[model samples]
Target chain A: MIEVKNLIKEFEGRVVLDDISANFQKGAVNMIIGKSGSGKSVFLKCLVGLIRPTSGEIRYGGRNFLAMKNREMKRLRRDMGMLFQGSALFDSKTVLENVMFPLDVFSRKNQRERRKRAEFCLERVNLLDAADLFPSEISGGMMKRVAIARAIALNPKYLFCDEPNSGLDPKTSQMIDELIQDITRDFNMTSLVVSHDMNSVMNIGDYILFLNEGIKEWEGSKEHIMDSDNDKLNDFVFASDLFKKIKEADAIITGNEANEENRKKLIQRMEEEAKDL
Target chain B: MTITGSLENIGEYALLMKRVLTPPDRMREFFREFFKEMYKLGVNSIWIVVIISFFIGAVIVMQIALNVASPLLPRFTVGAVSREIILLEFSSTIMCLILSGKVGSNVATEIGTMRITEQVDALEIMGINSANYLILPKITAFVAFMPVLVIFSMFLGLYGGYVICYLTGTPPVSTYVYGIQAFFRESFVWYSIIKSMIFGFIIASVAAYYGYSVRGGALDVGRASTDSVVINSILILMTDLVFTQLAMG
Candidate 1:
């Protein structure tokens, strides 16, 4: 489990992450969703030690991540794996070499052992045929798969993915979502994903944290987001006509339009955003 | 930028050096990278060095021989002057300035591109010291190979002079050969070799500093690469002046 308490980050007198507290459970995909410039990336970077928060307590497995010594942080980073939005595979390395990188650096395995492990990771990602191919030789979805294979090569205790579905088509996005969910369950690793894709959120979000302009506006499951009373969350989330129609159809069928008044208010807010744009 | 900002950058550069100089996390991987870098940074550069030094040496000989047109001066003066020019300055200082443009810009663009593309961040996220993993091998490989390049330049340069004397026959080949062997100081060769090694370090490290400091997109990477070459040239000249003064002043 991971815990963040009273986390605050400011840049040049502008607050980016307000005093925020949250917990991410082990073996479940915890999702952080927000509009752009809403501090989702900053919050994720802080958790990964890429950015230092202004003030906070970040505990990973009962250890104070914020206050660990350099050596300790180095040791702990081995247990963390991150998948970048751009896939960030080493352009110079072939697919198999990319997976074997962390193992070569940190594991005491022999040559055959390391190669075998990297091959296993590629096989798991169904990318064994592409082992000899460089990242540039692959498609966007295939690159993301390679990134996933490399990320899980170490069997990290925590897996963090930033916008893993940003540039892919719907079918590939769904496949990636299922893959993330399957790995989290099979490895029982604490997974934290930052995305704005409602398809992913509704399909795989076991837990969700919603940030609106750097503050936690709501936190719950996908079902809860549909009925959430927060005007900003509703306006931003259901801005798509498809999700709104689904919500309306569900209300009509279940006679659970207890928040029908809330829906009208959200429509009004969406209209206001459109006018401003 | 203000003085405070410049000082902050210097501090950051120093800290980055510390990170880069740390021991590798794994020996096998370090050696693998080291050998690859030796080939990339050192072996790949042999042809350019050979071509430039050979032609320049021929030019220096012809220029000096044409200018010493008086019977009052000895016939060997052209060869002696060419030797001094190549050994004392050209092969070491000027050649390195040329290489700074070739190799320095390369290191900067490669690393800066990696920075903007998030490859360096990936290394850091993997618990690898990106500086140590990426820059150290290049630095060591270049530093190790620079003296050999300088030696090659020295011999090739002298041979070019020999060819010029043999072909032109203005100064007799025997006279030029004697002049080449005259006043040949072992210390001058050592000095040039050592200076070239230092130049190698400056070229690699300063380029790396510029690359690692990059934060923007492709345009920023281009700026960094150009900036690295400019700074490397300036630093190489400045260090050359100091080294020459120490050795001959």
Candidate 2:
């Protein structure tokens, strides 16, 4: 489990995270969702110590990450695995080498041991045959798979993924999401994923924190999301025509009623966003 | 703002110093990386350096042979001219110019791409000091390769002079050999080698620093590469002046 307290981050005197705090649980996917520029990525970076919070305390398994010394920080980092938005694979390295890099850096494992472990991770990611291929030779989806394989090579206790499905097609995105969920469950590690993709939010979000322009707007599960009464959350989420149609269908079938004024407000918000789109 | 810039410079220097003092295993990895970089530098860059060195020698010999029409001057003066040109300037500065285009640009582009793609961040997240992992090895490789390249430059420069003298006027072989032997001191060769080593260090560090410092995305990487080349060129020239004054004097 990870506990964050009063996290505040400022870049060039502009506030990105404003006294945000939350708890992330192990054995489940903790998803942070927001529109672009809404501080979800910053929050994720802060938790992982990639970006130092201006004033906050992050407790990972009871240790204060912010106060750790350099050596301690490195030890903590060894326990971390992050998958970046761009998949961030080393271009010059083949997939096998990329997976073995962390082992090369932090472990005393011999060449055979390293190769065996790397092959195992690649197999887990369904990328066994692509081990010898360089990142440039692979597609984006394959690169993301390689990134995931490398991230899990160390069996890290904390996993952070930033926009893991950014450029992927919807079907591939769902596969990636399912893979992450399966990994979190199997490894029983604290998983924090930052994204705004509704499909991802609905699919793998065991717990979700919604943000709007740097403030935490709402937090809940996918089951609670469809009926969430938070005006802003509902507007941003159900604004999609498919979700609106679903909501309308639900109301019609179940004889559930949304007040006339609320229905009008939802339609108006969708129209406004449609105009901009 | 000036203070901020100076402080940043100090911080950069301090970081480099700290990177130098890391644990033995980490330092060894850096040297291993240096070896890899040196292999790339030597193999990839030899043709360019040799070609440029040859031209530089030929150009200098052509000018001296054409202009020094004085019968009173020793015919061996041609080798003296060649020796001075190679030992004093060409071996160090000209080779660096070629390397700045070859090795320096590659370093900038590699690290710049890493920065923009968040591979540097990946390293940092993994608790590996990216500076030690990336920049230190390049610096070490530069220190190792630059001196050898300078020696190559000197040899090529002399060969260029010999070729030019032979092709242009069929000057007596003994005179050219005598010119090379005349007024040649070990100190001059040492000075040139030292200067080249320093030039190599400056070029690698400046290029890597700019590449690592870039933010945003691909455009930032491009800008960093261009800036690294420009800044590294200027720094190499300036360091060359200081190195010559301090070492040759």
lDDT of 1 by residue, A77-116 (tens): 9999999999999998999999999999999888899999
Task: Give a tens-digit lDDT track for model 2, residues A33-144.
Answer: 8889999988988887778999989998999999999889889999899999999999878999999988877778888998999999999999999999999999999998
Candidate 1 whole-model C-alpha lDDT, 0 to 1: 0.91
DockQ of each two-chain model: 0.83, 0.74
Query: Which run of 10 residues does model 1 chain A get worst, by summed lDDT?
Result: A248-257
Positional deviation of residue B158's Cα in model 1 after best superposition, in angstroms = 1.8
Q: What residue runs in model 2 are displaced by over 4 Å at the alpha carbon?
A: A259-277, B1-17, B20-28
* Among all candidates shown, the one with the greatest TM-score: 1
Model 1 residue runs over 4 Å out of place are: A256-277
Q: Pull out the clashing pairs in model 1.
A: none
Cα lDDT of all candidates, in order? 0.91, 0.85
Cα deviation in Å at residue B181, candidate 1? 1.0
